[model samples]
Structure formats: C-alpha cells, structure tokens
Target chain A: MPENKDYLNYIDRTAPKSPLLKNALLAFLIGGLICVIGQLIGDFYQKICGLETDSMRTAVSVTMVFLGALLTGLDLYPKIAKHAGAGTIVPITGFANAITSPAMEFKREGLVLGMSAKMFVVAGPVLVYGISSSVVVGIIYFLYKVLIGG
Target chain B: MATRLGNQTIALDKSVSIINTATVVGTKESEGPLSPFFDVKMKDAEWGEETWEKTESKMQKEAAKLAIQKSGKTADDIDCAFAGDLLNQCISSGFSARELGIPYYGLYGACSTMIESLSLGALAIDGGGMDTALAVASSHFCTAERQYRNPLEYGGQRPPTAQWTVTGAAAAVLENGGAGPYVTHVTSGKVVDFGVIDQNNMGGAMAPAAIDTLCAHFSDTGRSPESYDLILTGDLGRIGREIVINMMNSSGYNMNDNYGDSGCMIYDIEKQDVHAGGSGCGCIAVTACGYIFRQLKDGKLNNVLILGTGALLSPTSSLQGESVPGIAHAITLSNKPGGEG
Candidate 1:
C-alpha cells in the first residue's frame, strides 16, 4: 500500500461544460417572439395613432419599456424572462422593468422616501446622465445656431 | 503553476477539523420585528414574510447544532461566526449571531454565501487568527418568493426556466487543527456581463457568473480542468447547469467530469412542483453539510471546488428594467491525514 493515500475516492471527475448554444438559441427564438409584440406596438403607434415615425418610435419604445418594467416589478417579467431568455429583456421591456421596480418598492417608504427618492435607487445615475447629456447637446446646438446665423 | 500544497519536501500534512457551526434566519421570529412586509402583502394575498422568519431561524439553529455536533465541539468554543442570508440587511445571520452570542462577521455572496463564508472562515483559521469558525447562510421561500417575484398566494404560472428557491440553510464549522481536508485555495468571481438584460429569472442571469468564476478559478490556479475531484455549482438548477456546461464546452473546456450542481440536488422538481430547480444559500450549504460532508468524512472525495453564484439584483432593480449582473466565489476543500495532536 502506498504510504501517502488520497482521501477523495469518488470525485466526479468529468469534462468541462458548454451552455451557450441552448441559451443563445433560447435567446434568439424567444427574443424574436417578443419582438412581435414590438412590431404590433409600432404598427399601433403609427397606423392607429397616426403619429410621426420618429416621435411614435420613441413613444412606443418608452411605453413598451415602461410596461415591461412595471410587469417585471409585479414579478411578471421573470416568468417571461425564463422562456424568452434574452428575447423579452433585450427590448424596451427589460429597460422598463429596471427603471420602475425601485419606485414601486419604495412607494411605502413615504413620498419622499418611497416615491420621489426611490426612482433613482438604481436608475438614478442613468437618468442624471441622460438629462445632463441632453442639456449639453441643446446648449451646443444653440451655440452653433448663433455662430452660423441660422 | 500548479501550486501544490507544500511539496517542498519538509511540509507535513495539515489536518483541519470542523469544530462548530450555527445558522439563523428571519423565518422563526414570529412577530418580533419583520411584520411590515407581511402586513403590506396581506392585502395582495401574496403575503410571505409571516412564516419566512421562523423557517430561516429554525434552519439556522438546526444547522448550527448539526455542525457543532459533527465536529465534537461546543458553541462556546466557536471563536467567530461567518454568515450570510438572502435579506436586505442580512437579518437572518444577524439575528443568529445575536442569539448564538458569538463574535460574528456578516458576508454576502448571494447564493454563494456557502463558499464565501467558508473561504472567509478558512482564511481566518489558516491565518492563525482563530481556532474554530462557523459559516452559514439561508433563504426563505415565502419571503424571497414574495419579494423577488410575486406574492406568496399570487398563484401565477412560472416559466419553465425559472427556478424554485429552496427554503434552505446550511452551516459548516472550520477548525484550526484536526484531520481530513483543509481549505487550500479560493478564486474570486469576475463580473461577466454579456449585456443580457433579463432580471425575472435570476438563474438565467447568473449562469454566466458561474461559468465565468469556474473558468476563472481554473485559470487563476493554473490548473487544468482535470485537477480537482469535484466542481460544484450552487442553485443554477437544471437550466443554469446545462447552460454552464454548454458555455464551458464551447470554450474548449468540458465540465462533464466531477461536476454536479446544488440546485439540481435539493429537491425533485417533478415531485416538489418546482418549475426549474432550487436556489438560495441553503441549496449549497445544506447539501454540503449533509451529503457532501459525509462523503468527505467517508473518504469518497479528496479535493473539491465549490462555487457559489449570486445574481446581484434587488426586486426594485429588476423591476426597473436594469440588466442583472452576477458574482461567484470559489472555495477549494482538500483532505489530508491526521496531524500531531
């Protein structure tokens, strides 16, 4: 018998794993399925509402995102996320889920603590950046307008 | 760069023993402090916090007693406590530490609390700061389900990919001296954000974290895939485990050997009606404390690597449309012969 013995006798020594294809396919197929909802929204926003293409695009995107986020907060998104994988979350739905959950959770903390203060818990930084960048672009456009005498 | 444990010709085997371990959870407190969540959810019929605290606390105490009994050590001999729970403020662990009356160190690695606390406790012992340490973590079905997804009684259909959070907890006692395997190495997880944005089913979100950290562990240790006897993952369940294997295999590494997952073992999803599998610290901790630890004591496994993966997302964050990010922690356990007592 060997003087030095190995203590572990039944380690399930096997091979490395790969999970990308299944998940990727899940992402693609389910993700594509969710896009049908977006297409309908686009059509509704354009043909039904008769809104301008660019403005309608933004509005529909924002709405889809908001509803996606709201449903996510209500714990509906994970169910969709499970089947769709990346499909449901890749669109405006995931964004909406991310932005609103904080507000909903904090709503009870009081207006200042919950509603007003909670909106920024996770999404605050992104919101700040978006606003500041938009303002900067507006200022730059105005400066260029003055320079070009437009 | 196989950093063999002291093969310098003069190093004797280190036999590390487990002395004591304990756990605490919010599910047991009845009505002491955590009535707010239940009070609010009562209106929605998805109330969960009511029974969550009691369950968590019961799990903690039971696991602690089991660990202490297994190690042949008493609670007073425990020098420090390492604990984590799926709670906002780690109430499960905090309350346990307060009740058990030991110096405590609270840690969070999401579902990775098992490995996280073990790694910390092992370090505390290995660094010569303490003799015995306990690591524990827990999650309650009612509280976690309600907070993360819907109300307890909401009765919504879960997607096939979603996993069940096991109402679970586990405890492991780490001693400075004894027999068997010791904590040899650890690898911290890297945030593997593939820009995939889905926060609902956190198992899917965290599969990447498991792969990233497991692969990173292999890389950091400079060891090949065949080095360890066991490589375990926490709470990714069937879907997450499949994805992890797929991702790793695609990367020129196959994880078919010595690989089992915590989420897969905790419960029979068919019998239990769990859609996917089990998640939470208890998933890993309980499995290790029970079956896995027995195997170690029985000499079925020599070395093992346990990786606990956690998706770093809160209920509010997921609801806000933010992409879920995740983390994993890896702890290595190896056995050796008895030392000079």
Candidate 2:
C-alpha cells in the first residue's frame, strides 16, 4: 500500500478530464434535434388526424414514446445517447428507452421476473414521483375550483 | 546471484519464452482496432450457446486449445493451465479446464488476471516446477454487466466514464525455449486503495497501484524508462494512463513517446463509441497475446514492459461502500540474446 497522501494525489491526478464545453454543445444540439422531431411529429398528427389540441398533444407524446422504444430496441438510442449524453435522456424518448431497454434485456429471464419486474428499474422512480406529484397538484386545483366557484 | 533485485522485481536466471498465443473475441470487440489480430471472432453473442456465461466458457476453451495447437504442442504437452475470468468462482475457467483436462490454477486478479497468470506461469517454469505452462484470462460483456452493474435489459444509462467490458478470451503458452518473445523479469504489485467508491471510474481507482508497481520495478531493477521500447499498462484506459504518465514524469522518469494502455489502444474511442475504452480480464490478455506478441515476434519491438492493473471490487464490496483497492503486476518481455534486451 502506498502512503495515503501519495495514493490520494494519484487518484486526484487520474480523475476524468471531461471536455465540458464540447459535451454541453453536443447535448444542446442533440436535445434540440430531438425536440424538433417531436414538434414535427405533433404537426404531422394535427394535419393528418385533425385531432383537437389536448388530444393532439397526447398523440404526439405517444408517438415520441413509441419512436424512443423502437430506436432503443434497435440499439440505436444508446449509440445516440453515447454522444448526445443527457440531451437524448431528458426527453420523452429517453423515458421510452428507459422502460424498453430493461424489458428487452430481461425478456430472456422470463416475463414475471425479467420483463415485468425489471422493466421499470430505470424509469419507475420518475413515473412514481411524477404521477404522485401530479395527483397532489390535481387535488389542489380541484379544491380551488370548488371553493372559488370557478 | 539471487534473481531478486529490489523489493518487488525478480530477474529470472532461466529465460521463459512465450511459445504461442490465441485470442477469441465477441462481435463488439471484433469492431475494435486489434480485431484483425484476433484468432477467431464470434459473430453471435450466444456463440451457439444458450447463455452468455456458457459462451464465455466456450471462448476460453477454444482459446486455450487453439494456443496449444498453434504452439505445435498437444494438450498433453502443456503441464498446467492458469486461467480465470470475471464470473463467480471463475466458472468460465473451471468449465474450460474440465474440457482441456490439464492441471489448473484458477486465479482472480479482476481485470489483471492476464498478467497475473503470465507472471505465475513464467515463475513456475523459471523455478523448474514446470517445463511448459499455459496462461489465459477471459471476460464477457453480458456476464460481467449482470454481475457487477445491471441486467442488460435494465436499460440503465452508462456514464461517459464507464468502460465497456470486453467479451473475449486470450491464451498463451510459456515454455523454457522457443523462437518467440521471452519473459525476463516480473514485478509483483501490492494492493493499494485511494478510497474511490464509484465503480464507474475504475481507471481512477487503479492508477495508484499501477504507479506503485511500475516505480518499484524501475527502482529494484535500476532500470529507467528508456530501457523498454514500450511501457504498456493493461486496461488502465485513457484516464489512468495519463495519471501514470504524469506520476512518472514527476518522479523524473519521462515516459512520453513509448507509453501505451492496452485498454485505450484496443478501440478507437471516437469511432467505436467505447467511451472510456475497453476493460475486463480479456482486455490485456487479448491485446498482449494478439498485438504485443505479434509485434515482438516480428521484431518491431525489441523490449516491452506490460503492467496489468486490476480494480479489486466485488458487487457486494461496492454496495457496502468499500473503496476499490487495486493491484498491478508487471513482466518484461524482450527479444535480445539470452532474453536480456
């Protein structure tokens, strides 16, 4: 074993020297491209299906999630995510990939333990917290509407 | 005179030669820089096996058998086999050993198993315990990922600092005399920990140990950086390689042009998308066997130093918040007369 100080020094020196500016630029480009694709899909849905605003929004979300899963299944999302970093991961497609990736991986383990149970390993927390917080917010909105006679 | 030079190094009185080598890699590894040098590249992940673990065992078996055959020797010619892998109980090596039917020493040095086996194999031969020995190490991406990190289906995002575990196996035959690169010296390393708990950044955890072994080798042998044509670190990746260079520079050994890391050199990082680079017991094993062995045989490189570094952290150890301790063992392979290059 080396002296504590010497080991610490080497560890410090060896820490990753990430290119922050370059990564941020790539993230911005990729994230923006993903958002652009989402908007384009939403526009296509509105023009083609003639759905109302809220329904169109839901359609777009579903479409994006489907695309995310499709890309992830093809193993293309990870490749994109490798370069795009958080850009691809922060979008609806990222969530789709999160759910789809585990499901595909665990499919070999069988549905009960592998697919069904492990599918939510990455996105489960996000889904839980996001839905719970939305429910609480919905309750507050309902109470406000009832009391204020709006 | 005692071959023991300094605290960690031993200068072998009898030369131990690398008789032959064989390397087998998975599809992903076949896309790397050293792919052309591998003996066999499997097109399928399953490799006709039902499971990834079985496939890894198959790889080990094929590599060991192929190496012995390439050396113009049968399995009966190999006195013992030193083999290991990342799997629990080293089942990959054990299962392969059952097939090879040779006396086996199942070693575990994490990613450093290649050099560990080589060091032991050479020592056994040099010490007159064995005339011919085989050393091998293997790792599979799927098997290692499920055991150490997450299931393949978990779809967890790998941080940029995380390295991709190699799916490959490499085997070498070391004997008393052969027309090949010879093992001349070895520096066994001591375990050192810098208290790095993040398993993703293995290169950081292992840098100190590599430096310790390298420095000790130099001090004990009274040899400088200029002695070797290349100073190779096994599976240190990009980050740890830089740290090693910086430490060596500060210590007054300027190893600028002749330094290489097997982990980083195996893949073209930008082209391959292997972020930090390749790792595993197979990383060094394959590179040393395929690339270094070829270069030395062709006399492109006269003398080389190989340091295999391993981050000793199990799944339980990481979860328990134990810092990753690391170790690195070094061996000198040279092409000079009487193996003194």
Task: Indicate which candidate wins on lDDT.
Answer: 2
Output DockQ, candidate 1.
0.03
Tens-place lDDT per residue, model 1, A44-85, is 999989999998889878877777766766677766665566
Tens-place lDDT digits, model 1, residues B1-341: 12333211111223445543333323222221222211111122122333455456656756776677767777898888899988888877887777787789888777888878887787677667787888888877765774676433221335566676766567888886666556667676766554435554556668778887777666655565577777888888777787787778988787887788877766666766566677887677766665566666677877777888887778777667666777888776667532111
Query: lDDT per residue, candidate 2, B1-341, as tens digits?
Result: 22898789888877689989999998888998898899999998889997788899999999999999999999999999999899999999999999999999999999999999999999999889899999999999999997887656433446667888989999999998776588889899999887777788888789889999999998998888888899999887887788889878999998898999988988888898777888999999999999999999998998999999999999999878888999999999998634443
lDDT (tens digit, per residue) of candidate 2 on A1-150: 334766666566656556778778988999899999988888888888788889989999999999999988888888788678778888999899888987887777788987899888778999999999999999999999999979
Question: Relative to the unseen true structure, what is the Cα RMSD of model 2?
Answer: 3.9
**DockQ comparisons of all candidates to the true complex:** 0.03, 0.24
Per-model TM against the reference = 0.62, 0.84
Give candidate 1 regions above 4 Å deviation.
A1-150, B1-15, B19-50, B337-341
**Fnat per predicted structure, each in turn:** 0.00, 0.28
Model 1: fraction of native contacts: 0.00
